[model samples]
Target chain A: MDRRDFIRTAAGTGAVLAARPGAFVRDLYAFQETANLSHVEARYYIKLPDREIECQLCPRKCRLGDKERGYCGVRENDGGTYYTLVYGKACARNIDPVEKKPFFHVLPGTAALSIASAGCNVNCKFCQNWEISQVRAEQVTAYDFPPRDVAAAAEANRCPSIAYTYSEPTVFYEYMFDTAVEARRRNIRSLVVTGGLINPEPLEALTKVVDAIKIDLKAFTQAFYKDYVRGDLAPVLEAIKLVARQKIWLEIVYLVIPTLNDEPEEVRKMARWILKEVGPGVPLHFTRFTPMYLIKNLPPTPLSTLRSLRKIALDEGLQYVYTGNIPGDEGENTWCPTCRTLLIRRNGFAVEENAIKGGACPSCRNPVPGIWA
Target chain B: MTESLVVIVRGRGVRSRGGEIAPAVLARIYERGLGLLTGQTGAEEALRTLFAPSDKVGIKINAIAGRELTSPPAVTLPFAGLFSRIGIADRNVVIWDRTNRELRAAGYALNADGPGPRILGTDTAGVGYDAEPFVHRNIASRISAVLTDRVTASVSFAILKDHGLAGVTAGMKNYFGAIHNPNKYHDDHCDPFVAELFDAPPVRTRHRLTVLDALVVQCHRGPAFHAAWAAPAESLIFGTDPVAVDAAGWRLVERLRKEKGLPTLAEEGRPPLYLQTAERLGLGRAAEADIRLLEDEV
Candidate 1:
């Protein structure tokens, strides 16, 4: 749909337009005035000679000249110092169910104060939220929601967690990091939903502040990452390993596109890799893909493809393999991997029943790996 | 087999001893350059050969680097004034960039309307990017309404600079300002994206001419202005063939880089390979042999 139609529909639905469900819509017509951008100094960049700076935040270590922005289009180098133009400028904010972030293992069915800024490090061809993610900071409307305000909003909204989502959180690293720190002070958890294109130093530092991270592993092969995602699979794999090694909770979501990344063999290889590196206890979501952005030529992924991929991961010894986007399906529920007992039953984003007690299956007393209250 | 004409006109006293542009001399350089490139005797006739009297002309400039390296008013205004000589109304011509902030930083006054040769940026309210993306091969970007809806014809009046990614930012790369997401195209030396972006319908159809402002060429460490590496070429390169004009500008930057004892853009592994790709796409001539370069002094 065109932007005007999208805006009209977004205004009408309010919650459906966002990445997460139950997300309240703000003033969709308030496109930011061109001059309305933040000038906060950025971190993780080294100043070079001739008023240039090298951004070390993502795998694309963009070495930029003065007044030049990085690939993310949010961070810029201004006369030897780098600054983020999106700091405290949230383009999208909503109160969503934590299940929408699909963090099945972390405080499921609770509300997460989700936030996003404009810009992303990688250019995924089929990005669902490309309206906010693909554009630069100046292209989108943003609100002046600072870190303390975000924490306060979460607490005021009675949300137990705050989520950095919609766009790639790595591009808006400072805002997410500071907000996570502020949320921690308020005893609210912070969750990160990312493409996992971040550097090791920043990802490690991020794990210290956040409660859990859901990394969208787009595909298995480097070729797919290169051609379709415009990123590297190696770094995302490295990030997964690093995040799993940390004290924080981790989950993986693989968006299976039809005829592009839906080979059973590739999915099998990825399942085996995750089983070997991150272990079977970590949840692996095989999400269905809809035609969006530049990939309009392809059809929405078949339900059978998602179910089969989930079976492959499960067959490869993954304990928590789930299928997403097809709500109310039997794959939406969490089953006890040990005794085949239903632990938590879900319909769409809603939690219908919980049979797990004290993080263990109620029937067999098998420890279910999750953050259960 | 068809030869593209690229005119390089050097005005010796275009810049004053204090390093300011002499508008009269710069005007003379533009007249000579356009006259030679279009094969027309008078400046008015030269412009008439390219633009119709009733056409809305958009002069897209490069103002990302601020005033130091942008297409200065001393250079651009006089050129825009020539459109008036050809019977195109002053209000029908606009000199614009990406944002009003960048335009103002480059010393351009904000003139959405009620002005001569209306000067403004794409960020002006009601003049933002098109609601939908202009999708083409390897390119899907929301183009500025200034180019898509307003202008009937366009002139890529760009500044010449050495880019870190694209190797050379010239007339063809100037259109990057017309799109919302230029940062996404800087991969792999901007090879096919730059060519593909220019080949997009919004640009390939409306684009009529290219005029590279080489008055103060940022031959090295640019797209940004590093004074230590900048050179005063005091010349304007003009051509109707966008690819050929940029290829000439790239050659000029390489010459300046060599004189400064800097490594060539190719040796640095960042040549403007997009020119060749553009040529392959039947945009224009890219190779030096295919371009018939005509040099003149004003």
Candidate 2:
């Protein structure tokens, strides 16, 4: 594929064309022949004897020997010092609607300048952006988009917020944290889209900079996590609770897959846990699942499944629950918990009307919890 | 049942003081190893017995740790030259690893065209990893095009070393370089994943031989370079059974570790359990009793 195909501006939408799941080439880019890797020393790693180091950035805490990379395929251990290879290397960058990140409650009807480097801590079987997330940094073409440049581009594009998205942002924690600092200096909000596999210390540091975070809670059971996601469910749950405890706005997306995580009892239990731990005000998005990456045997989740799961979450006392990936559905609209009035009308990513005035419901005058400008 | 044979050919002065392989001694070691492996008097006869004349062969080398501890070209090139002597076209053989940088760091000149045994990496312009993942058991990864598309037959030419996670990385673990995401499989001491990755169609169907470069074995604190723990074994191990070869290499590592007063891999809680998993999958024998090791010095 041509390198130009990776970076293109869409007509009229002002959204750069996002590279799809198969757009990446498995070969290293020609410029990467000399290895265009970053040498910035990583944080949260302990030096061991004999030139080994244990990375404490995420739940994996990967102990690596000299010249070995972590599970993320980006960070490396060179002579007892850990360094991130993807710092300031942008593999995918685009201007997207904040709703595209599925953060309906935070900065809706605005553009988010989204960026991601190559690598993810976990290997989710159903990764939709595997082209960018599942491969090593050299396998995909990357540009030198530094932290300052990222914030400048967001301002130039008139984007209110900059999103560390597409790939797992936590894998590029240093880059994301520094960019968030730069974006905050420019009065631009920063948003994070991640799998929530980060350790508490890093998450606490990250919470101090970013304005909003959307965690993709893959499943509730450890078995589902082991079988499909190749990660531990408990750490993800802990990360979500940790982020929720902070002052930053938090949202959750649970992709409901058939015969995997769509059991009614499991969904009910997850909803109840979220209600009790994260409270009812946090918006929960039950997104539809499509067959992608390593999981092609299963079909796209039926619209009925998303609705039922959303109903389970709503019945468990979540104030703002929405169904995603099925366009024009009524479940996409947010309703006031007090009087059942439509607080925000949304068709796919397009917002028709939002009746929440000054972070309160117009009809019932109940407090709606979100970042309303 | 007959025991599987694993030949250990030792060279008296194969490794020079500068850590470079002496080409003549390395060739002698390979000749002796291949002769014993095929029960033939000549290396060319042994090559002819193992591979067809028209086969496009891939000499997959381990170069992840750079030149310090890698399968050097001085060892593998002469070994590939044996195939050329036996009528396999020089243009049909490619000595490759995961990346050009790693291969270059391992002292290999990058050559993708016009020569004997085209030395290159999977990152070569026309040779990358296959776009579609070859899913097998718990493995869903893109195999290198060198293994999946370009070469009809393969030889795993790997450096023997003690791995931090895999306990001991040998012939089978060498194929980890054949995929795009080896970092994902390093969990659980590389058990079942290493065996399962080898069981994948792209690897299992094409693999023909395991020639381990044991000139300098890093028995402790490795798969990396630690000068204090490295031993100059000056040997080349050859076997047709992939698991049996790695199992023997594991014993060699354990021997060195014991000599240095280090704990056994099992005592350290990382014993390349993948060999047993491979045995269960009918890949090869892992037990020492099932293997017949023949040692001879060149």
**TM-score for all models, in order of appearance:** 0.95, 0.97
| Docking quality tier of model 2 | medium
Please provide, for model 2 over B1-298, each residue's C-alpha lDDT reduced to its tens digit, 9 standing for 90 to 100. 8888999989989998687677888878878898899999868888888899889999999998888898787887888888878788888999998899899998999888877788988888767777778789999998888888789999999999999999999999999999888999988998889999999988999999998888889998888888988988889899999999999999998998888899999999999899999999999999999999999998
lDDT of 2 by residue, A1-373 (tens): 1223323532211222243323335434343565566889998999998899999999999999998999999999998899999999887787778999989998779998888888999999999888668888787767778999888888877889999999999889999999999999999999999999999999999999999999999999999999988899999999999999999999999998889999999999999999999999999999999999888999999999999888888888888889999889999998999999998999999888988898999998999988889
Pairs with steric clashes in candidate 1: none
What's the residue-level lDDT of B230 in candidate 2? 90
Candidate 2 whole-model C-alpha lDDT, 0 to 1: 0.88
DockQ of 2: 0.57
